[model samples]
Target: MNIDEKRFTASTEIQKPVPTKRGKSTTTWFALYGFLFISLALFVYVTNVLLGPLRLLLFDPPLFLRINELAIWYSGIPLVIGTALISWDLFRNVTRIRDAKFVRNDPPANRFLTVALTAYNDERSIGGAVKDFRAHPLVKRVIVISNNSRDRTMEIAEQAGAIVFNETRQGYGACVHRALREALKFEDTELTLLCEGDLTFRAADIEKFLAYIPHADVVNGSRIVEQLQERDTQLSLYMHYGNLFAGKVLEMKHLGAVSLTDVGTTYKLCRNVTLRELMPLLDPRINLEFNAYFLDTALSAGVRIIECPVAFYPRVGTSKGGNVNNRIATRLGLRMLWGIFVDWKGFFHD
Candidate 1:
């Protein structure tokens, strides 16, 4: 059954315009008088030439297509354009964005963090990663998962302040399945950042980024190509072009809240509720081909994602992800593309 809903204007009468800041008489007396001055000059010049008695002046300038004649040219055009632009700006109202309020779930407790390290075999650098995660102001817990590591990777992670979870019995997805459940056990976990254990980030900067997310579903840091100017980790030309293409493709899709492939992004912010809701999407044991495999899934379930521009420091340890230089990565990208087409219905369900 269709029900008719009647809606009325919410406010009373709209307000009238008060004199604006720009409405003040400007200091540019020249602009206001330029036209009048030119008109006066032309009038005097014409009068001197036409009046027989006035022609006796020493400067009875002959109007024989003189220098200033054709040169009177379109000089006033700039003044008109400038005035129009100023008037447009002066009349337009500057809008202010209201800040969103993110509700806190639990009473504030001492720094308790549940940093998720999704790793395959980051044994060489897992220790450093855990230390960095623990160094945060309130990180109380570190949940590390050996996605499919064969070495002493889990042990190194455990020693570095993380309670390592083994997923050898299940697929990488299933390991994340188990890891997230454990991370959520702490009642006072104010922030949870799901990160791969291979990359390095400034702990302070990461925290600053997280603080902005209380009102946002996801706060992403976009890569600034400028920062990489002095460094050699320049994004391959192909990757740069590919990323641009991907951005345009996203616009074409017009999925208002849809995220980019990088949205799984090296970093992600989670409100406890959003995290809790997302855990179930982990397919028990498939390596979850893409780390952001759950992004489209999350949006389908209704989550907001936003990108904030930032500079990324080049990788310090063994890099797990980078320019799509290899055939494997290329194939993986193709798969993602194909999935986008086939699952458009699910990805944009909202």
Candidate 2:
């Protein structure tokens, strides 16, 4: 038999088993309620700290006493309830909900990949980024989706031998959604690698992603490794810790389903088959906070996600996204929190 036939026989002999369904209703209820109550308590505490001086200046003795009493009750009640629910869920049900079974599958029969790079006014980095990924032996094609760039990003990408498309929807999420759709059109490649054209990530990490792809439907690139990241990158100390906090909250929300870190990174690898199924479920209207939304929605639909450590470096151009400043990053983080706790549809307003 030929190599293709041998691979086919091997794959057919050891098919991957479907993940078993677990009872997660109770876990989801407790996790959401616990997060809600704790967040309320923290908000109340911060509010009191900021308004303490104002309270002293504006209120007389009787009124001040009443306000203080109300503050204590507002904070204390949520704090107690949140703490109890979390502790009970942790000790009682987390283990049972977690997937403890061990299963192994054969490596992919076709390792060739279609790479989609998201670009927006990245004239300085587009050419080099295109050439870098095109040089990878496993990368069959490089696609650049320019999100209505006003610069020479599309021109440079095309000159560098990248197939370029313009996504006129005008948002990071829209660009990414367009890139995925374009990558999914290729019949020669079974894997779709999604990344930015800002040069923060490199093509060498494709091997790392391939190593983990057999175990997950999506292999998310993680920038949390201190040793792997460059010192002068956009991921400042504040952004780094904030990403970790958001990741932990997501993990807690799913309870025992998965462990995650660095939900803010744009570099990830998805099986084409998986993306074909997950596309209809995602909302491209989720602007800046779309990565977090993608992960949450994927997990909610039982998609297996695994993290791979990838090196991060400084981008070539001015920052346009959340890492531009601490204030903006905080706002984006809060929006992520709101989507996680409240509803994603409410994000359209604020």
Candidate 3:
């Protein structure tokens, strides 16, 4: 072959597209869009028969009840199919969690776990948060990331004996990424506890995380337990259900065999190995719903995860995250869902 011909062949081979199991093909995308179009058309048709003028325009008055009956059956098919699928998944997850055995981590007298707290204008509770995590027997050091806080959050955290660092990039995901990065810096850090310094999640729940860490690569805390959750907490009823729905959707996406009821909780434990492998793949540009993104990416990376109930207390200061209200929480949930099902890499961050 000629030199130019060989060079062109090499360039074409290098530029060839590679198929990925994680991404959908063009044909699959078109088929999905077609299915959605058909479903939407059916919905519109049924609505026209039930509420629109088409019922009276096309059908006789005596046959209106028959048309309505047909419309009911047509509209109810999708709902029935959807409900049955959800129910079957729920039943399978419940049975799996109920029957599965978990190994608990029993630490020795020496501590090796590092606690990392993400802080953003949390001066009111940073000190207490630092102290609470330090009080845990298994926690060796407390690392706090002050995400460009305009207040005294860094000072208070440092005063409470925490190793504080500043992340100039302003976002919850950025702060958490920095926190995990700093936690891994310690030589003796075998496991990293990631939490917020806002005091919504207490340090006392570390034992629950420890108990579940041996069973999974990452142990996520679930605040859905009504008895464990304190009264007047920031997690309202609407926010709780939204978190539960997002968690279930994620569970179905990656970890269908396991049951998950909370995805927005900031309290979680990660083995150093999994954290090192998973952190590099995460995009810090993801904003308020970063926890869901984090969990989804971890699961996609083949990280085993299990959720354990943890006590959730009301924050010492005002809320800044997506849990401020139902409307904001719903928006964040929708973003999380989109990131999970669609193009996660290009959803929010360029």
Candidate 4:
């Protein structure tokens, strides 16, 4: 071959692109749409099955045929169309769920604080919990309230070198009230996080909880259920069931998110000034053992409750609170249930 012909051949080889069989976009779309169509069909069936009975209940005219036809047959098409559109949007949103990740810093946004932890009989795991808080670069100071422990909880906590406070309060709620009462007296603290002695949080998550507080007076970390690996004993499940019930009630009342259930948590971050003022209003009779729905009761007094689902670890130590005959959790659950009405204010925030 001539040099020109060889050059042209080499150029042709270089310029040729590799063949790639694009997977059938047509088949994928068909499958997705087909699933949606089947879902719509199921939606139509279920809506008719459920609403048909309701028509009889409402239609006191005793008109069986008219109500039966009107209830299901008259509305089937719209129900199917509505379900398909909504399911499509919902499935689209499911794609974005995994986008969430742990964020240690809250950009230029979060108001940082010296996270204050209070402990009583936490000899087993206070160190790890405090270490978890101190691990975050945002943590400036950790004040541990080693209140009247029967064991070496104070020694382990003090050895941890946190500014430890030893108090003689008979109740966890009382200890917290006393601890915060003393802490607020100093006036040096900007923000104080009141974490449960046992609860575990992810790194830098306190910042996420704090980011919403200036906008919301009380910013609470909520579990969005993307990850809730913490399995608790009866105490934990009782708390879980209470929380689920409270969440539904709040939704019904249009009340914004409040951790009405898991209120024993060690992760309460509060404005020192605001908390000090509110502490006096708290029912001193309550303790962490059987009570603390006072946090929910605070909502009735117009305290803003913003939920931020902080990551949770199952209880390293659980108690016999939820045993078969222990009316304790039931009573507390009743308090939470009753408090929804007794201490509830119509939702003031979105």
Clash totals, every prediction: 4, 0, 0, 10
lDDT of 2: 0.86
Which candidate do you rate higher for TM-score, 1 or 4? Answer: 1
After superposing candidate 3, which stretches have Cα over 4 Å from the reference? 1-71, 80-111, 255-257
Report the number of backbone clashes for model 1: 4
Q: What is the C-alpha RMSD of each candidate to the true structure, in Å?
A: 19.1, 6.4, 13.6, 15.8
TM-score on alpha carbons, each prediction: 0.58, 0.84, 0.75, 0.57
Lowest lDDT 10-residue stretch of candidate 2 = 18-27
Residues 111-211 of candidate 3: C-alpha lDDT, one tens digit per residue: 36899999889999999999998998778999999999999999999999999999998899888888888898887877889999988888788878877
Q: For model 2, how does the per-residue alpha-carbon lDDT over 105-201 read when each residue is reduced to its tens digit?
A: 6467789999999999999999999999999999999999999999999999999999999999988888888999999999998999999999999
lDDT of 4: 0.54
* Candidate 2 colliding pairs: none
Question: What's the true lDDT of residue 60 in model 4?
Answer: 38
The TM-score-based order of candidates, best leading, equals 2, 3, 1, 4
Clashing pairs in 4: 195-266, 196-266, 220-308, 221-308, 221-309, 222-308, 222-309, 223-309, 230-314, 300-343
lDDT tens string, model 1, 1-350?
22322222312223232222222322222322333344445655555345544444536567733534443434345546545543443333112101211232222233345677777677877788788878876667678888678777888888887888777654545656666677677677765666667654444456555555643555555453455223554354554555444443332232333335342245555666667877776454434343445554554455555555444554545554434255545544544444443442232211
**Best-to-worst lDDT order:** 2, 3, 4, 1
lDDT winner among the candidates?
A: 2
**Model 2 Cα displacement at 253 (Å)?**
1.4
Q: State which candidate, 3 or 4, has the greater lDDT.
A: 3
* Pairs with backbone N, CA or C atoms under 3 Å apart (clashes), candidate 1: 111-138, 112-140, 113-139, 113-140
